[model samples]
Target: MSAPLLQIDDLSVTYWDRSLLGLRANGFEAVKRATLTVDAGQTLGLVGESGSGKSSIANALLGLVPPSGGTINFDGQDLATLRKGFPPEIRQKIQAVFQDPYSSLNPSMTVEEIVTEPLKVHTRMTRVERHEKAVELLKLVKLPETHLHRYPNEFSGGQRQRIAIATALALQPSLIVLDEPVSALDVSTQNQIINLLYERRDALGISYLLIAHDLALVHHISDRIAVMYLGHIVEEGPADRVYHQPAHPYTQALLEAVPLLDPARQRARRAERRGRVTTDMPRLSEKGCPFSGRCPHVMDRCTARMPPAFTVPDGGTARCFLLDDEPNEQGRSKD
Candidate 1:
C-alpha cells in the first residue's frame, strides 16, 4: 500500500477554564486521542455533531490549535515538530477551505487577488503569470472570467465558496482540509460544490480531509468514515459498513435522526421509539463511556467503567459495551 498522505496518532487537546476562585479547572476535553490515516488520493470523512471535536481536530492538523499530546504527520513529516513556524515546502503542500467562506476570504480583495494571493506568497511568478494562473484556477472551479474582477460580496454563497476553494487550489496543495465546505450553501448548491471537489481531486490528484455532519454527503464522497461523539471516535470504518450496520449506539441514534425519503420505511422506523431519555445529560468524566448516559443499549458496566473499543464481526471497531458479550447480556437483562 502507498504511504498515507496524513497520519494522526494518539492526538488529544484540552482547554483550561478559569475558576471564580482564580484556580485552574479543566474545561471539557475537546478531543481525545484520535488516531486516523488518509492515503494519497483518498478522502477521509470526519462526521459528527457540534461539540464533537470535529473542528478541533481540523485545527490541530492545520497547526491552528496546538495539541496537548500526540503527533500529526503529513506527507511523512511531523507537523508539530515545526513549532517555530510552517515550513515553505509543507505550506505549499497543504491548504484549507474553512467553514464560512465570507469570513475566510479577504472582503477587500477582488476574486482575482484572492485566488492569486497563495501563488504570490509561495511562488516567484510575475504579475502577468500570476493573473494567468489565477484565471486558470478560476476556470477549474467553473467560475466565469468576468467574475474575477468582482469582490466577494458580488457573488452568491455558493459562488463565494467556489472562490474559497479556488484560493485553496491556488497553492496546488496535495491535501485540503474542508471544514463544512458545503454546509453554508443550499442543497442544490451543496451538490454543485461536492461535484467540484470530486472534479478537482480527480484532476489534481489531491486528497481531502472532509469534515461535516451531513451523513448523506459523507457516505457519498468518503472512502472511509469516522464517527465522533462528545470528544472521541466511537465508530470508524468503510462508509457502507458504518452506515448499514452501525455497531455503536450513538451511530445508530444519529442514523435514526436523519430523515429518510421512503414514507413507509420512515414511518415504520420512526414509530418504534427506542427508549426514554432524560433532558439532563451526563457530563464527560474520565470514568465510563462518553455515550453511556445517552445510549439506548447502555449497560451497568457502561456507567461503572470505561469500555474498550472492540472489533466488530464483519469489520470496523466500536467503543461501546453493546459489542461486548458480557455487557451485551448485562444490558439485555436490564432492558
Candidate 2:
C-alpha cells in the first residue's frame, strides 16, 4: 500500500525566551513530541486552545519556522533536514491559508494576481493560461469569474477567505495547512466555507491539516480529530469517536465547553462541571502529565511522570494514564 501523504513523528517546536538583559532565558516547547498523519484526500482537524501549539505545528509544516526536534516526513522527504528551507518544488507541493483574510492577502494585488501568483513562480504557464486557470479556480471556490478583477477590499470576509483558498489551491498542492480558515466568518458563512472546502478536497484529491479551536465545527469536515492541550496531544481519534466518546478528561471538558441548545441541560451540565472543577488550571510542567493539575481523574502517578500515548480501543491514542491498566516496569498493575 502507498504511504500516507504526510507523516509527522515526535515533532517538537521550541522558542527561546529572552531575559531582561537580552540573553536567552529559557526554551519553551510549544509542541512536544506531537505525532499525527494526514492521509491522501482526507482532512485531519487539529483542535486546541490558543497557544496549544496548533499554529506551531502548522508553521513547522509550512517551513515558516524551524522545528527544534523530530522529523516531518511529507511524501517521503524529511522536511526537518532542509536547513535552508523548502526548495521551490517542495514549496509548490505545500501551501497555506491562514486566519484573518483581510491581512493574509495582498490588498494591492487583484484577485487574478493573488490566485495566479503561485503559478507564475512555480510553473511555466503563460499569462493567458494563468488568467484562464485563475478563473477556473474562482469557480471551484464558488466565486464569480468577474470577481477575479476586484480587489480583496471589495469582497466580504467570506468572499475574501474564498479567494485565499483559491490561491492556496492554485498550485494543486498535496497538502494545505488551513489555519483557522473560517473562524473569522459568521456561522452560516463558516458552514458555507467548510462545505466548499470539503467538496473541493474530495474532488481534487487533496489532503488538509485543518487547524481550528472549535471541535464541533471541525467535526463537520474532518475525517479525524486531534485535541491538544498545553503542548501535548491529549487525544486523537476518528472524528465521530473522539467527539462522541472523548477518552481524556481534557477532551470531555472541551466538548462540554460547547454550549448546548437546551437551557435546562446546559445549566445542569454547568452545575455538574462546577462541582467537579476544584482548582485553577495549571501551567506547563517539565515532567508529568500536562493536564494533571486540573484533571478530574488525576492520580498520584500523573504528577510523577509524563503519560505515555496508550492505544484507545476502537479509537486513536491518548496521553493519559487512566488507560494504562497494564503492569508497570516494576511488574505491578497500576490499578
Candidate 3:
C-alpha cells in the first residue's frame, strides 16, 4: 500500500533544433510522455534500440539532464525540481553504473579510492573506516583485498565493471541506474556480470533501472519489462508475459531479432522475414503514431491519431489499438 520507490510521470526530454542561423527552433523530443514505476527491490528493464531515449531517461533520473516536462518522484521527493545535478542529500540516495567499464572508472585512482569515493564525499567516515569499508566492498563484489591498491588498468573488463558496481553500491543507494551495464563485455563476461548483479540485488534489496538494447537479456533479470520505440513506451508488462506474448509490433520485432539457438528455427525465421513486405512507409505518416511508418499492423486510423496505452488482458499495457475491444466500450484500461 506504500508508494513505489521511484515513479516517473509523463516525463519528456527535448533538445532544441537550430536553423542555419543557429537560433532555437522546434525541438526534437528524445523521450515522450514516459510513465513508469519501480518498486523497492524491483528491477525495471527498459529496452530499446539505439537512440530510443533509454539513456535519456537514465540521464534525467541521474539529474544529468533536466526534463522538459513531467515529474520524477523518488522516495516521495520530487527530483525534477533540481535543475542541475541533485544536491549531496539526493545524490547519496541514487547512483549509476555506465555501459563501458573500461572508460567509466578513472585510471588514475586505485580500487580503494574508486570504491570508497562516495563515502569520502558523503560521509564523515575516517581514513581507517573508509579503508575497512572499501575492503568489505571488494569482498562483496567477489574481489580480494589484495587488489585494493591496484589501478583499474590492472583488472580485466569484467573486473573493472565489478569495481564500478561496488562503487555504485558503496552509498547503499535506493536506486541505481544501470545504463547498459554489461553490453560492452563478451557473452561469457556479460552473463557473469548479470548473475553477479542479480545476486547483489537480492542480497542488498536494491531497485534498479536497468537500460539495455537486448530484450532477451533484460527479460532474464527484470521483474517487469518496458519496451520503448523511438521515444514512446510501446509495450510494458510482467517479464514473462511481455517476452512470450508481445502486444506491440515493435516489441514483437525486437523479440524476433534475437537469434534462435536452433539452426532450423533461425533459418525459418529469416525466410519468413524475407517473405514479408519490405516496402517503405511514407515519411509524412510518422506524424501520428511514432511507429506507424514501420508497423505491419498499422491501420488507416493509426496514421491519423496517436494510440493510447491500452491494458492487456493478462497484464501490463501497450500503446497499440489492435488490442481494443470494439464490442465492449469498458474493456479499455486506464492504467
Candidate 4:
C-alpha cells in the first residue's frame, strides 16, 4: 500500500473564550484527537451533525484554522509547521469548494476571472492561456463558454456551484476539500452536483475530504466513510459497510433518520425511533464514553470508562463497549 495523500493523526482543534480583561477564560475542543486518512484518488466522506466538528476539521485541513494539537501530513509535508504564509506550492496543490456558492465566489468577478484566478496565482500563464484554461474548466464542469462572461448572481445555485468546482480545479490540485458542497441546493440539483463531483474526481484522479451531515448523500460518492459525534470519530470503514451495517449507535440513528422512499419503511422506522427514549443534549463527560448518556445500550461500564475502538465484523472499527467481549485483536484503543 502507498502512503495516504492526506494523513491526520490525533488531530485536535480548540477555541478559547476570552475574558473582558484579555485573558483566556475557557476553551472548547471542537475536534477531539480525531484521526483519519484519505488515500490517493479516493473520497473520504466525513459525516456528522451540525456542530459535530465536521467543518472544523475541514477548516483545519485548509489552513483556515490551526490545530491545537496533533499532526496533519499532506503528501509528506507537515501542515503544522507551515504557520507563516502556507507555501505557494503546497497551497496550489490543495484547493477548496465551499458550501455556499453565492458567498464563495465574488460577484464582481466573471466566471472567466474567478476560475482562472488560481492559474494566475499559481502559474505564469498569459491572459490568453488563462482564458483558454478557464473555458476548458467551465466545460469540464458542464458549463458553456457563454457562461464565462456572466456573474455569479446571474446563475442558479447549481450553476454557481459548478463554477466554484471549476475554480477549484483550475490548478489541477491533488486534493480538494469540499465543505458541504451540495447542501445548499435543491434535491435534484444536489444529485446533479454530486454526480458532477464524482465524475470530475474519477477523471482527474483527485482525492476529496467531503464533509456533510447526510450519510446517504456522501455514501454514494465516498470510497470510505467516517462518523463523528461530539468531536470524536465513533466509527469508520468502507462506505458500503458503514452505510449498510453501521456498527455505532449514532451511525445507526443517523441512517434511520434518513427518510426512506417507501412509505411503509419510513413509518416503521419513525415508530421505532419514537419507542426509544429521546433525551436532551448530553453533557460532555471527561472520562467515560461521551455518547453514553443518549445511547440506548448504555451499560454501567460505559459510564465508568471510555470504550476502545472495537474492530467490527465488517472490517471497520466502532467505539462501543458492546464489543468489549471481543478479543484484543478485534478491538484496540485509538488513544
RMSD to the true structure for each prediction, in A, is: 3.8, 2.4, 2.1, 1.7
Clashes of each: 0, 0, 0, 0
Which runs in model 4 stand beyond 4 Å of their true positions? Answer: 326-331
Model 1 error, position 320 (Å)? 1.8
Clashing pairs in 1: none
lDDT of 3 by residue, 258-322 (tens): 98999999998988888563456434444577787887887877787667789888899998878
Write model 1 residue lDDT over 138-161, tens digit each, in one string.
Answer: 899999899989999888889999
TM accuracy, model 3: 0.95
**TM-scores for all predictions:** 0.92, 0.95, 0.95, 0.96
The candidate, 1 or 4, that scores higher on lDDT is 4
Q: Cα lDDT for residue 86, model 1?
A: 74
List the pairs of residues colliding in candidate 4. none
Off by over 4 Å in 2: 18-24, 327-335
TM-score, prediction 1: 0.92
Residue 293, model 3: lDDT of: 80
Taken over the whole model, the C-alpha lDDT of each candidate is 0.84, 0.89, 0.89, 0.89
Q: Which prediction has the highest TM-score against the true structure?
A: 4
Task: List model 2 lDDT by residue over 2-103, tens digit each.
Answer: 899999988999999999999987898999988988999989999988889999999999998899998899988999889898998889889899989989
Sorting all predicted structures by TM-score, with the top scorer first, yields 4, 2, 3, 1
RMSD of 3: 2.1
